[model samples]
Target chain A: MKTRIFSLAGIAVLLALCIAAPQMLDAYSLGVALQLLSWIALTQSWVTFSGLTGYVSLGHAVFYGLGAYVMALLWQSAPLWEILLGSGFAGALLALVIGYPALRVSGPYFVILTLGLSEFFKYIVIAVEAGLESSGRLIFGAPDPETLYYIMLLLAVVATLLTWGLARSRWGAGLRAIREDETAAETLGVPVTFLKIAAFVISAFIPGVVGAVWVLRTTYFEPMQLFSPTTSFTIVTMAIIGGSDRAPGPIFGAAFIVLLSELLWARAPHVYLVILGVLLVSFVLFVPKGISGQLAWLMRRRRA
Target chain B: MNLKSIALRAATASAAMLLAATAFAVEPVKVGVGIAQTGMFAPAAIPALNAYKMWADDLNASGGLDVAGTKRPVKLIVYDDQSDFTKDAAIYEKLITDDKVDLLLSPYATPAHFAIVGVLERYKFPMMGSTAASVQLKAVKPGNIWFPTSALPDVMGPELVKLMKAQNIKTVAISTLQSPFAQEVEKYLKMALKDSGIKLLSSVEYAPDIRDMTSIVSKMKSEQPDATFSLSFPGDSVLFMKAAREQGLSAPFQFVLVGPSAAFFSKIFGKNLDGIVTMGHWSPYQTKWPKAMPFFEEYSKRYNETPDYLDVALAYMSCEITQAAVAKVGLDHDKLRKEISSATFDTIDGPVKFDGVSNASTPTMFLQNQEGKPQIIWPASDATSTFQKKGPWAN
Candidate 1:
């Protein structure tokens, strides 16, 4: 029944998009909307790793950027769909490789190590060959927007589905346990290290794919674009703000943050960051469970 | 016979996929704008966007840009690069490959532009850039894909030396923000200062975002150089000026670069901006071109703001040259840019021509910032307002 409802809702959105895009959206607005959707996908995927397991990563852009660069390099040699799948697989492989060493560290040290690892990977792996082809899109690039938009829309749906599946799984519960009391979860034979690494791998996959698609959508990529801290930070913040554990949390947080930042941007740039800092502090101190948690609380009160 | 049919069938299948996805049938001439809308480049991007919008509107109004055979309307497809180098690099690739824009609008900001230009160089597209003075664009060698907007800071060393000698001004103090871009200026200008009898009073550098710069200005004052050449940006530039004024540390003659000048500087600082000078792109007082005024009127009316040195000189001139180039050599890509490089356009700056190596138009005028206004004064041939030295340059 839940799957039916999910499928129905997904179809409804896609139907609405197809119906509305030609009529309502100009090429420019579609471009912006597609970009916003890509970021949402990225942020939601971040929740699967850092939000659920309490493994805060400040350097997810390394994955996102690498995914983009890898796909871009592949794009020169292959087709768009191949690049998308390749980027996702590459991200997963990278996460699994790094996750072993990264999962060794516990508590705050793990977070710091993940951050440092991303930075190290960026300088060593990606930028080394970036100079080999410097000018222009590096290869036959500027993708048609209509195609990129459809690709991005499909990616967003796929990412959301992945998150939905994770939310319902036994692994999801295990991750929550790891977040709450890691020692207790481990004693229960939750395979805490393995689960954490899996979460990181799974979380990184969507962003990697999304990043590649995002480059296709925008038709541009460079080192700074892919590996920016802003990409990681924004995604992580959205997950935390919405409600880290639930499926709805990241979506709410992503939309809320993007909308808020856009409005703040029009007024004065950088003030939105201060507002984000305040929101984070307030949420941590007063509303520990996050925005979705608050919504759930209100619903329970109403039922009573 | 079977193998030939199979190869033909594969070609047809590929063509079918291309048609189904996005028709690559090039009917209208497409142009691409690869400006960074989100990242550190946003400030520079905003003005460039405005300039493009103005140009796009003008092109459309005049029945769009002319192609050789068909007068296809110009469409500028803009993409937000979101300040990711990888993303931007990807964007340019897609633009040239898929969208298949005939001309790609040059991006803003040095680092981003320099990176995106690689795609241009890779594809060998004629990219007219508005990035800051970077020797990397053309370097000592010339590439057809390369064109930069401003006079490279290397040019500043020789130009400033000439200005100082011409004015009999010597003993200069210099300061630049601790940015790679600003550092480039300092590196080149310091070398040029070597050839001149100008004694180095004191040269200082500051953090890109200095909270309080009074000490720096105070230190400059203590050195007591004949003139000060300070390089600053929008935020720090204004702060430095206000701080220097508050501290009563006034250099009689100061040349401020990459800071505030022209309308933006005037709108903000007004009379307090007096006695400042900057390397400028164009001077209204210097140009008598008929095409120049219409550009000013259209520019001022649309944006409701006056044009600046680079705005009038580089932005407008580049647009004119681009239009004239394509018009001269029908979108042949090969012949178009050489025509652009060789073709002389009477710009707001004067009879402008590109020196392929530096991508700069020689006989470029150095602007004087007098009483909070930018007026072209250098290159005496084009001088309208004789430079009146009031504070530091005053004897």
Candidate 2:
């Protein structure tokens, strides 16, 4: 039954994407969707690690930036597949390294540490690596556009699939247990350490890969741009709005925010940021399970 | 968001049918105008786009941009990229494939338009870009596909470099936008000024939200260079001036600010900007075009405000080109491109033509910031304001 639902939903979404792609020959709408796609990938990764496992990441932009840099470096040097694998490995490796020390920390400390780590990357890219000189070495180059777009789309899909796969896995069950009660999970021999490490690493991997794709698409990189606190907040808000732990939460959150951004931003053209912040707060306070989360709960309730 | 596809389909079917009729009837010239009508880069885009519309209306007033004696009304196909390069690319594809516009007026931002330029070049569309700042964008292989309409920093940088050297004030410092457009220009400016025996004390890439650069300014002040250089935009420009003044910091006799957008930098900063040096976009006094007086008069009267240099630079120049092209080429599309490429016309900005590189235009004056207004201080002859020897804010 679960497998059949997955097939049906995936086919529906795929059909929607395929039909929509050709129809969107105009630039205005497609561009918004592309940006939303980037955030969707980012927040879903956040949802996978933080929402499902209850381990919030404040510095997820670090992964995006890392991905951007790696993809930028790989462009023109490697083929498309090689760039993807290389970016994924680089992000996964960075996540694992950070995860070892990071996932062990508790409460707000983990949050602060993650943010600090993200900032460290930001400063390194902007201040130290400004103009692509990092410790007397050139580290990044802008990737070709079509190559970057295809890679980013691929990464978003792969990350989405990974999210679905993890949700039904043993590790996912362990994460749920850990979220409910870390002490009890440990007492139950759920391998809390491995589960946390795995979750953190996977979360980092998605954003990192996405970041690399971003840099490639831009063909330009400045550290402060990819590693900023605003980028992290945007991702977190998307995850929260989407019902962090659900399959479609991040997608819905990203779409909702992207729409608000288009209308408010188009109207004002000066500052939609304050508006976005207010909407996020209101959604959290009143919307309960976010748009997708609420829908999921309602559908279940109707079934009961 | 999902409505984008449906919208695209509707726009294509309707717009193509509308355009095809006029195009078949008398071959009405199709002009492409690209802007960030949607995304993250929309702020700068809205004002910049006013120039395109202003030009369209002005050119259309003369019964449209003329080509030879066969006068055909010009059509403007406006597209909103929603501030995405991917979308910009897609639109360029449609503009080339379906609409088949004769010429393209690009968006305001550097990164988005820069990417769009790559796509346009592929399809061989004649494009005029004004808002991009990347110096590399100017170096495109000599052709009529793209022309840099505004006075780019690459040309202006060298002109300013001459001013900085003449002053003999050695140490220089700078900050630039983290955007690809700025990144490309910053790359060239740094390289061009590298061998000029100037010591750049610090070069920072700061976010647009720098309220007051208390630390960066103070740190620079401690070193005490003869002059300071900045490659920042509007919001940061005000903050830098205020912070530099509040901290009683005077690092440079000149400030080559990139995005002062009109001579309003001085007006915004008040007396604090007296000695501040900057660049000019389009000084009314500098222009010799016939329509300059009327256009300025109309803008001032309608808006109840003075016309600034940046808009005057783009608005007048684009309208001037459209007029010249229409007069030369009648109503044919390909002929319009040829006319635009073949003829060098006098504009409000001065006699200008695309020099093959979509980046470089005829270089304009590098004015010093006197009383916050970038008065033409160089070339001694074009000096509009009496050389206020060391502005009030100058040490």
Best by TM-score: 2
For all candidates in order, state the fraction of native interface contacts they contain.
0.08, 0.05
lDDT (Cα, tens digit) per residue for candidate 1, span B1-395: 69999999999999889864542344656778766576665654566677777887887776667666445567888777554444454567667776788887766655555555545555677766554455555542344444535556767668777777777777788777755446566777788889688888887776443788778788887887767777776667777777667766555667777655446666766666666777765655445666666776677799887766563346556566677677767787788767766777665555666677455555545777766556766767666665656352221
- TM-scores of the models, in the order given: 0.62, 0.79
lDDT per residue for candidate 1 within A1-304, as digits (tens), equals 7757986999799658754673577543555566667776787788777777887887678778778877767776776678888898888999999888888877889878877887677555433432242322333344655666777667676677777787778988898899899999999999998888898898888888887876654444545446666677777777778887776787678777767865674345446568879988888788777788899899779979
- Candidate 2 overall lDDT versus native: 0.65
Candidate 2 C-alpha lDDT tens digits along B1-395? 58999999999999989976764677667877657775555655655666666667765676655666655667788777666554455566656666777766766655555555556545555555565545555444444345544446556667666767777767777767554444444665677688888777877777555566888777777877777666666667667776777777766464745545453554566666556666554555554445556666666575454455564466446656756776776535567567667678777666777655542445556555554444666545555564343433422
- Give the Å error, residue B228, model 1: 2.0
User: Candidate 1 versus the native: TM-score?
Assistant: 0.62
- Expressed as tens digits, the lDDT of each residue in A19-105 for candidate 2 is 466365344344455677788888878877888778778978787777777765566777756776677677778888888898888
Docking class of 2: incorrect
DockQ, structure candidate 2: 0.14
